[model samples]
Target: MKELMKGNEAFAEAAIRAGCRFFAGYPITPQSEVLEYLSRRMPEVGGVFIQSESELAGISMVYGAAAAGFRAMTSSSGPGYSLLQEGISYIASAELPCVVMDVMRYGSGLGDIFTGQSDYWQAVYNGGHGDYRTIVYAPSSVQEMADLTVMAFGKAEERRNPVTILSDASISQMMAPVELPAMACHDPDAPAWALKGKGNGHFKRHTSVMYYMNEYDGYVRAKYEKIEKEDQRWESLETEDAEIVLVAYGISSRICEEAMRSARAQGRRVGLIRPISLYPYPVNAFDGLAPRAFLSVEMSALGQMARDVALACGMRAPVYSMLGGTRLYSCSDVEARIGEILGAAHGAF
Candidate 1:
């Protein structure tokens, strides 16, 4: 049965169902509810929850817990998310599998407590100082908030690397009906690489400086390549015959979908491509489509996701940007922008 739940609460409960036994996070706007929800619930399930003194402390706690073989997680927003970058780099280097949720707010350097998609570059690209990449999922609805939290935990373990759920303030605070997943338990000692006590003598494992080895470099490269080839995910609507395709994710994608339907009703050849995975970046979704123009709609001052769309199309089509910054674009707002782009395209010929 589906229950009405806030987005942040849904993510927290979903993490528990996915067997996240240790959660460490500091409070931040638009995402504090995650930590708040976990505080009251983790103990009920015999899981560990810590309201850390800082984002840095929270992420480090997660690292330690994950190293000890527990499924661990952390949540933050904006600057708080920025503070986790260094720890994230360390966790990635250590090859630990854990989950991190960045409920993004607007702007840079202590941005406002409002929804924004500006963290696209930070989440998809490694903001941490490393050559490693984390799998990133962007959820547009409350249902995805629950669904993708479960998937993030599984993908993190399967790939043996940290996974991120990049949500924005709007989705993080909204309330909707969600069917939560079944509860499960994780065995901390299941992984061979996990730290065991001194009882297992003559064998020791270390997680640092292994990347300095030439062979490990090749292994990491191959692993990311495999992920790129196999894990790209997206949703396409009328793209098969679209002349102008709008590329978006998170809340912006929802608006684009509405605009697509509005345009289609009036006989406009508009389409939508909503990316679910940001790291491997659903490049495959662009396959065989020869749209004349690709428009990137995002809530960032600069269209952060436009570059990826341009690269995915191999510059075959001119890519445009519809930036919303601290606000969201309405269906009419998106529809008007599409008409303007189409008008300009017609004038060019």
Candidate 2:
């Protein structure tokens, strides 16, 4: 059944249905509803819910729960997410499978409670210390917020690492129709590496940076290469014969989609490439695309994703950026920007 739901509520419900039995998080703007919804619902299904005093403690709790082989989760926004990075690093080093939601907000330290995508670098690059990467999912709509949360758990476990659902207050606070799945059942058997009850007189210690630290980098690199090859996902629109291709994701992609439509209507050959997995980044989306120009639209002062786009496209085409901080861009604003780039490139061709 389809229901009109806010983005936070949708992911919370989806997590519960995806067998997430433990939730630990503090109240933070934009994502507080996720904690609120899970607080009441987790207990109904015999799951554990914790209202940690701080985001640090909350993510720590998640690490503990996941260590015990339970599907665990935590949610927060920008500043709070930064505080939890230490725990996230530990979880990554220990190779624990868990889910984290970052409902992005604008600015740094005590920034506004409004929506922003400034955390793209934090989410896709150095989320924490060390040479580690978390699978990052960028959900543009309420339905994706829920659907991706469910998929995150599977991906995390399949890869035996943490996964981040990267979203912003805009999508978190907005309401949209979503079709939820049935509740999932937990697996009875704990993972072989988990610190479960004594097994055959063997002791298990879940430590950060698995034994043989020297070989750790090689191991992680192999996994990341596999992820890059196997997990890259994206959506492309009208790029077969286009002069400009817009690279965007999350909430910004929605605006760019509108811009693409308007540009097409104006007889401008424009297209879009929206990355669903921000960490893997879907670099192949631009492979072999002979566009006249590439524009990256993002909700941040710095063009974080633009750097990724330039790297992905190997600077095959001139790359441009349209930045939006706290406020989102309108279709017309993006349309105008696309026109500007295309017009400038017209003379070069």
| Candidate 1 residue-wise lDDT at 293 | 93
Q: Write the per-residue lDDT of candidate 2 for residues 98-179, one digit (tens) a residue.
A: 9999999998889898879999989889668887899999999999998899999999999988999999988999999999
Model 2 stretches with alpha carbons more than 4 Å out: none
Q: Please give, for residues 218-239, the per-residue lDDT of candidate 1 as tens digits.
A: 8889989999998888889999
Every candidate's lDDT: 0.90, 0.90
lDDT of 1 at 233: 82
Candidate 1's clash total is 0
| lDDT against true structure, model 2 | 0.90
In angstroms, the error of model 2 at 126 is: 2.1
